[model samples]
Target: MTDEKNMNHNNEEIIEKAKKFFREIIAENHVKNTEKLENIKEFKVNPFTHKYLANFLTGNDDPKSLAKALIYPRVLGTSITTSFGQNLQTFVNTTLEGYGSTTTGMDIEFIDKLDGRKKYCQIKAGPQTINKDDVTTIRNHFRDVINLGRTNGIPIANMDCVVGVFYGTYNDLSAFYKNLAEDYTVLAGKDFWYHLTGDEDFYNKLTDAIGEIANEFDGTELLEKTINQLAMQLQQVDGIDE
Candidate 1:
């Protein structure tokens, strides 16, 4: 019993250490992204800077203030967002190992060399909001791939295009899939996870894993602590600059 308890404690420590490591990475990236944003002419002179600075000086760790300081700048049509997107693609790649490699011209790509087949994947965070422009873009890309194969005398008939969305209440996405050709597939929520994992209940397991993590640590407290650290760093920088 004592040995089992010690093992559990060690696992908890490992989890907490991993969480802290990721937090530090994100915080370091936040600082780097802020520097990049400051170089942009429009962002440099943006009125939001004054507000964010004022909030930081006041030690206000409000969610919006933290977002302005950390997340907003990173996501502002910059390379930071693109880099983050690639990181997320990597996460999916690691999670779906033994599947295939991530290829260009799509968000996630899978090549099955054994069958001379491939799956071009597009991933979105949520369901029920399929962008028409993105659909058009993907369709054009697939068309080009097929056309390219025909020109080279290597007919690629086993190619398929797919979209995977993270979460939604509704399971039926047939209406959206119908917009594409018969070779295309649209999967949402659990169906998407099942397609990738080949485990019908993997979605539930994923959610349960998330719940376990939440139970292991207080995410809210960690987030607040990070915001406080960011606020202090910004304040120090302002003092030095002035």
Candidate 2:
């Protein structure tokens, strides 16, 4: 009974540590994103005009989508999803250093708290970004990291590799991840978070934090203004009515 209690206590501490690391990344990125938000208007829109104009010339007659195209580079501070995955991995590296785990300076290398084995993960914001060709590269990376660790004194048996999908469940994962599944372990959504800190809800908990950040940062004023600007630009363009 005493042994079980100690294990539970340790698990709680690990979960708390992971949460603290997530908060640090959120706070740090909030500042950086805010700064980018200030200069939102300056982001280039020239490319979008040409790209969408071509679409207009083709079959896409909807001028309304132009605003969305503009928003990608301007608002949301240039792909928040992409930034979140990178930042999450980064903060985890920091936590690994302070915690019992060691930072391997690779993609996302850390020791799993639940198991004594070390994990080297290729963290992705979502499964959609992975392509068929990326599978081979991912596998090769794992092999290389294992060899590197062996050289550094960590045995091959003591280490494992994984493709950590930041969001979505296994069933929801894209077909591209099919190839990866045949090789190394692929943990997604709740399971992936559990693998990291032994906390199943870690994914949801931190993602809820991200939602709160979105609520705080997803201002309607700028969005409406940008859309209005794009609408006028579209009006200037010769609209093709189908």
Candidate 3:
């Protein structure tokens, strides 16, 4: 138990690098995105949608204030997560033992050298992250890749494609997951991490590392300041209350 515990703690080389990268990425997102909020030229209001939701949702609170609250953080959160997701792919490619970036979202470009067969992967953050349209788009992407490979003398039978979800259980996933699984490999959480690193416990270890690193960053001031900044901007918007 002690040696096992030590191994987990000592797995910090990658974890530590992940920690540094994660912090830098998050902090950079905060500084860069928050400034963009300050330079906002306008806030477009969908009068009908914004009006009804604000009245019913906030129990008659000022809709304009509500709009500011919604717009800033929602946009910021989406921007951060989307960019963070991109960085995550780079992180995995660089930090993991046998992964690297790909031209067409391939799982292991290196796999072809080993078995003379190519493997491609389209990765998502979670099972619920994809929708019906996304599935169709992914299917199209796969088709295009396979066609391109065929032109290069690679047969279809030698190509494998995967939809890899970083976290979730397959049995508990959505119809979208099932749809993808109908035609390609779908791995989630433990299965996904295991597929990449061949260690079933990697997901747990990864979460543990993330949890520890997360505790080091305190965002109290940032959050409060952002809300204030956004709230102030509402005053400048023309006809926001209407």
Candidate 4:
């Protein structure tokens, strides 16, 4: 009888340790801070916009978070943006309204290798009067979008092909583009986007990736329950000693 009781005590102590470890990990990671409650007031004014806002802010329910987490780190370190980056940006902006900026600072160029001609797929973020904060927000929003894309199985290495446009002198633009180009292959035409649209394979891969991420988020509740149970078991063990 004493042996059995000792074994139970040991088990309980182990569970307590586990609970403490998890609590510390969660706290240090700021996992609960996934959403900013104060910002909710501004977000709630537009219900439709708010819905998308939740996805970006709350990593638990946001499929985009998974995608972004997977892709952003790979590309951010590099000076060049890839095809995957462009497509991912398009996907995020379209899905989440008001997520991107309205600055016409960046332009997309399409080059035709055969004809030695260039066509433009110009996307104006918004207007010339757009503020720096808005631009930063827009950039960060896209970065999150890229993260979402990664969670969806879009590889960051494939981001080569997209170009950044800036409003400045030729030297500035050229220098920026040249630096970026050194690290990535620019898409010659808008054909890549069209190809992406028509590619059922890519869609299937994205769907599967998103589903996997959703499943992981859903598991968090179960994880919490398990933690609570373990803590209770530990408390019981400590009581028996008293």
Best by lDDT: 3
Models 1 onward score TM values of: 0.47, 0.61, 0.64, 0.21
| C-alpha positional error of residue 107 in candidate 3 after TM-score superposition, expressed in Å | 3.8
Model 2 lDDT vs. the true structure? Answer: 0.62
Q: Please list the residue runs of candidate 1 whose C-alpha ends up more than 4 Å from where it truly belongs after superposition.
A: 1-87, 107-118, 128-130, 148-159, 169-183, 220-242
What C-alpha lDDT, on a 0 to 100 scale, does residue 93 get in candidate 2? 58
Task: Kindly give the stretch of ten consecutive residues in candidate 1 with the minimal lDDT sum.
Answer: 37-46
Off by over 4 Å in 4: 1-107, 110-119, 122-192, 196-200, 219-242
RMSD of each: 10.2, 6.5, 5.8, 23.1
The better candidate by lDDT, 1 or 2, is 2
Candidate 1 per-residue lDDT, tens place, 58-135, comes to 566453364345534344445444444445545454444344433445566554223335666677655544567766
Candidate No. with top TM-score: 3
Error of 3 at 101 (Å): 6.7
Per-residue C-alpha lDDT of model 2 across residues 27-126, encoded as one tens digit per residue: 4564455444333254454653645653654446354455555454534554555566667656555544434233343456555657767777777767
Per-residue lDDT value at 45 in model 1? 29
The per-residue C-alpha lDDT of model 2 at residue 209 equals 53
* lDDT over C-alpha atoms for residue 123 of model 4: 35
